[model samples]
Target: GIKGQSLPDHYEIDSSKAKKDLGITFIPLKKTMEDLIVQLADLQTMLEQS
Candidate 1:
């Protein structure tokens, strides 16, 4: 939301090599949901304050 031109309608990431390079596995579903809920709550709080 900076006072400038906007981004293009497309984007890309070369994450196909992430697993091989980082040695990481899938995220646990429960933890992922918890984190998302926390983030959404934080955003909602900020919106209300603003």
Candidate 2:
């Protein structure tokens, strides 16, 4: 069976199951950019505090 959404971070999948069931995984470019932006902001705040 196919999954409608990606597995949560805490969940683990068997290697064999992943190889057979999940062909490919993709994250949206916008989400990736947003994550990077948040990370950069965190880093900037850390630098300012130091």
Candidate 3:
């Protein structure tokens, strides 16, 4: 029971393997975060202009 320990090693998820094994294509975290930030900024700008 290791608490607060993320995967101890930097393991790159093999996309092909993921699709074959898990049937899911993982989205990179950085890209997801960037998209969220951009959406939030756009929403804030719209709110301010309204």
Candidate 4:
């Protein structure tokens, strides 16, 4: 999907059996964004240092 005025999109992801058997869980979006922000900030710092 594009940034703005995007068309509807979808993907095929099935871990249903795994979820049932292995009890896997998903991370929250807020935590994902926080981790991504930290990673990007670290990359930016490395670029500046270089």
Give the candidate number with the greatest lDDT: 4
Q: Provide the lowest-lDDT 10-residue window in model 4.
A: 1-10
Clashing pairs in 2: none
**Each model's TM-score, in the order given?**
0.53, 0.53, 0.55, 0.59
Provide the lDDT at 8 for model 3: 52
Local error of candidate 3 at residue 14 (angstroms): 12
Candidate 4 on 9-42: residue-level lDDT in tens?
9868898988899999888999999999999999
Clash statistics: count for each candidate: 0, 0, 0, 0
What are the per-model C-alpha RMSD values against the true structure? Answer: 9.6, 11.3, 5.1, 8.2
- For residue 32, what is the lDDT in candidate 4? 100
Find the 10 residues in a row with the least total lDDT in model 1.
Answer: 11-20
Q: Which of the predicted structures, 1 or 4, would earn the higher TM-score when compared with the native?
A: 4
**lDDT by residue (tens digit), candidate 2, 1-50:** 46797766796655666656887556789999999999999999999999
Give stretches of model 1 more than 4 Å off.
1-22
Best by TM-score: 4
Rank all candidate structures by their lDDT, best first, as comma-separated numbers.
4, 1, 3, 2
CA lDDT, every prediction?
Answer: 0.88, 0.83, 0.87, 0.91
Model 2 TM-score? 0.53
